[model samples]
Target: MKSSYTVENPDYQLSPKTGMTRSHYIELAKYLLEGAFQHIDSFDDILTFPLIDGKTYPQEDSPAWRFRSLEFEALERTFTLAAPLIHNDPETEIKGINLRDYYANLLYKALTPGNPNSLPMPEDLPDSTYQYTCEFGGLFKTLLLMPDTIWSVYTEEQKAAMVKTISAWGHHRTTQNNWRIFNITTLSFLKKQGYEIDDGLLLNHLQWVVSYHSGDGWYLEQTYNYYSISLFIVYTTIWNRGFGDEYYPEISKTIEKSAQKLMESIGNFFGRDGYINMWSRSICYRTWVSGAFPVAFMLENPNLLDGGWARRLCSGSLLQFVTKEEFFVNGIPSLGFYGQKDYMVQSYSCPASPFLMFLPFICLALPEDSPFWTETENDGFWEDLGDASTQTLLPSPGLMLVNHGKTGTSEIIPGKVYYDDPNYSKLTFNTHFPWEDQNPDGGTSMEYAFRSLDPRDLRGDDINFYLTGKTVDNDSELRAKFTHSQNMLFNGQRDGVLYRQAIMRQPPNNGVGYIIDLAEITLPGGVLRVDRTRLAFEYELTLGHFGLPHIDGVEATVEERKLADRTVMIARIPGRSLAFITYHGWDQAEAMTHDGNNAEADSSTVLFARKTAPKVNPKMEILITAMLHKMDDSEWTEEELSPVKDFTIQTFAPSGSPCGVQVNLSSGASHHVDYQNIDGLRTC
Candidate 1:
């Protein structure tokens, strides 16, 4: 029963340690080099054609060429010039050294001295091409950091020129994800090369990064499903090198702690089938969860208690990804889950973006003696327990997950869009100013984050899943308290946090409610509850992607279904319906009727009303129902209940010491739920 119903995976040929016998590290290295060579002259071609004559360049051809030629050329030069340094001199002396430099030299000669069409361009280009250029910069930075190379064959003046070129362009840009990552990475490269740049400007850039930390390991991906954890882990790693445990030890420690929190997030994110929630913008940049490798590898200190466990937690997910061929597209890694079609790309991703997955190769950078390089793979977070595995429920947040066999969770379908845009997956909610809930209290706001952790792996004990989440509170220190039967833990810090826990699925037909209550929280002026629903949209529509309806003259209905000690209020309409109730300030937000038809309307449950039924005079009927409750400036509590659980309660939370968590469950009797098979997906 467990084998058939459990979320287990089939092995693939990728990882060296498990599944497929292929050496993926070597394949990935070839892929990265091929990507660099394949696009060597792409910028040059883009610069030669402007498309201003009103010619529509197919996606294979970028028309923004004329406007961004110089920027592209500079970026290309960054990569072209750094390639030679990858294999030679000191680096080649190290173990496992190989160099592929012909493409690098060809690309370098083509872009150096700066193509007139492509020099001195704004570090910021059209939104359409910015990510491509930045990624070019990232690749170049990675090449520069390689331990050896032919770069030393160049005169001092030439190497300095390269450093100056990178510094100038990287410093001028300013966007959260791009700038923060670019700055830290570039700064690390510069410091390594022994070049001097302004300390104040560099630190200021770091400070700006510090400001974006949202306490619980969240950094705004920006405007939409901005991925915070992946970006932060990478940026913090670069920053860690530059800081050297000096000025910002606390901040560094906080980031390390937050990285653990991020692992907890990844642990809950994957389902038993090795599936991951594909909810953010760079769906094409799918292997992003693996990007956390550098951060995890950095926490070598066992004294930090959870530090060692955190590394293993994150490494386990990475191992899960590489076991499958899902991480690559046409031999080159794609942007994410849906490949370039992923909604998060928003034109930011280019052919160069997925190479960022090489960010995980930072693991290779671990010295030969490092533990991560030698640790053996296990069943990971999904280890089998004595009886039935763990399960968790989050009702108000609209998420029901079950962890089978091990402490990890699972999802029936992985990477299915929870909203139209991957960005919407981070549903930061508020209770005040309903109309401005996402931006409550003017600028201060709250948001939720979800990530699918199944990297490209072929392991059988994989976790497959889709995660839907919402922020009930924007402030720090929100907690989900349960019995010793099971628990959820919380830890809040000034510079992000490390909150980790396992979420299990509730038993079938058990009306168990996992309440995620928020205290010291405020809602937007026009909102009642921020309900998040994950949907798979076959079309590309951006309007009302958050599940809010925009249909004019649409009517609504509301009803109250009572359970043992709770009342479940349901709002509906024929077929599919969406309801948006405005607070007008809580008291004023209520069920208002202006009817031409007669329908049963309950006071306790607000619903959109109509004269008759939609079957009769559907045209004249437009009823809206909203429930209201009043509260003054005093301590307040809000609770959401599930339909009901016949006879079981479960709780799980991260344990403080041996660095993990304790799982507790009470199911009345010994009969356990058994079923197996997990689900996972790969983008072809």
Candidate 2:
């Protein structure tokens, strides 16, 4: 059968399109739900859905059951959206399936005692896994969506069984991160149903969540990433709206302010095309990033996001994912973002995890006459700010973002990456290029080496860093607490330049150390990296230039040329050009290919410049300037193409001490970088 929907303004090249209205989204959700149910003979059969890539994830219980819960979770959002229409209009149906009967039957089968399809109850073990907590959250949410008629259909025993099931979940221990919401939401639902719950237990989770708020409207969930904002917004909004005054009045008050702060910060992550920064985990839940928008609307003072802009961003993000043909298999969303690329999946993510993308459909809960539905769509900040280049420094996250409106390219340089995950550790994240996982050596803007060590020893992998480090003084900043295991001593950023001073410990030789200093600068389409080393004893040092994205069969070419005193290595690809110019400390440049290292399966080519300290002096310093021009070859002359050549760098000290550099761009703008400053440098 033909697809039942299409998206408005679909980017046919990127996503698959079905339809664009609320009805279309509802139909799509229903279609996916039906497709999943078709594979199951009974609810227990949900444990038999095929795992993507035939990968086995470690779990005592079958993982496929999670998909069942996820499917129900997605349906809950659809049902809530359809509740008003189904109740107000008797003739309403989604894809010819009567909404009320369809949902009521499913809910009854899943929750009714002794039903073959009933979900397993929460285990009473003290160390029970968090999955049970998550599953219970979904079940409780689905029941909340039931209309009065559907609610009345449930026998008293069935309702009591659900209450007992949810009550057990509330008492069970859950993960301290986002999973806390599962307990909070479940208890809130039970309380709303007039069931008494442990007020202290509920209050404790709420207090922990509120205390976990780091700053600038972000909550720490394992590490700083997109989940910090997206999931936090959803859960807190539910708490504030459901049990605010009656349960935790203080939490309700704090969440309102935090939610607004988060809403204001979330808009920056989306590009003009509405795709979010692909820098964090759970990428399969693509449009769910728009979940924040719906949460904004649910707030009492919903002024954080304009109605027109909300619709645009929400619609745009939804379309970006839904339009991709590869997003689904047999009408069910696969375990990948656009297709079944398993590199991005975490251990906890199963085939059904992608259904979390349904969070945005919560907007369907709003009335048909709400301004969110009626307002003319606005293009959001990207369009509102015009084509001028703008930069925003998010201190809480230690992220510096530059949006080049004219070029439609945005780049983010994070000051802190606490995770070993490369998607978070990469020096720069670009909206146009989704991060790649297979090629660790490619797409990185910064890399370094140590003396006499094997390549593997010098290799930078899973380096833990964070932007939340406190500034000790004007000249030095403390490294984040998580980086204590590493040799880093002081870290600071000044005028768009990030700097660090550390003692490198050579492993296997306990006492050996090398004094290391590093600095970085990021521009719209370029980055500058510098490294200086002083060995306590005789040792060698090597520093690498940034690597550029390399896609096969798109006309790739590399050229080596001399510009004044520097040797410049330039790589040209479709619609873009990257130039790597080494000013002070490189021996040679080489082109290397990394397979499975990028977002796409195709290999990527990287250019590197290495520097080694002489044994006699054991001292070496290197500076490499990498610039990107976003225009295709046809758009510029040879002179205009080499933007890196026109840029000049002036050192603040002879040995690059204080590790300062001033870059004068061809545009006549100057960026002054002081490595000693703990706070990042201000841009021109």
> What C-alpha lDDT values do all the predictions have?
0.35, 0.58
Per-residue lDDT of model 2, residues 209-305, tens digit only:
8888877887777667777766677756756675665666767888888888877667677766666666767877767768787678888887778
* Candidate number with greatest lDDT: 2
Worst 10 residues of 2 by lDDT: 475-484
> How many angstroms is residue 677 displaced in model 2 relative to the true structure, after the best TM-score fit?
6.0
- Model 1: residues >4 Å from true position, as ranges? 1-24, 31-100, 103-111, 115-120, 123-129, 136-153, 191-196, 223-226, 242-254, 260-266, 271-274, 300-330, 335-344, 385-684
**Clash number for every model?**
97, 24
Tens digits of per-residue lDDT for model 1, 1-684: 011111123133222223311133334344444434433344223212111111221254555553344335333433322343343223321112223333334334433446443244344344333443364445444444443444455567666655555566555555655466666556656666677766676677667776766544555444323256566666565455445345567767766666665554444444433344444455544545555644555653422323233334444444444443444444344444322233234444444444444455554444544544444434444554422334333221233233434213342111112222223322221111011112111111112111111121112121222232322322121111111101222211111111212111122211122211111111111112211112111111011101212123454454445445333333444333223332111112123332211111111122321111112111111111122222122211222222112322112112211111111112222211111111111110
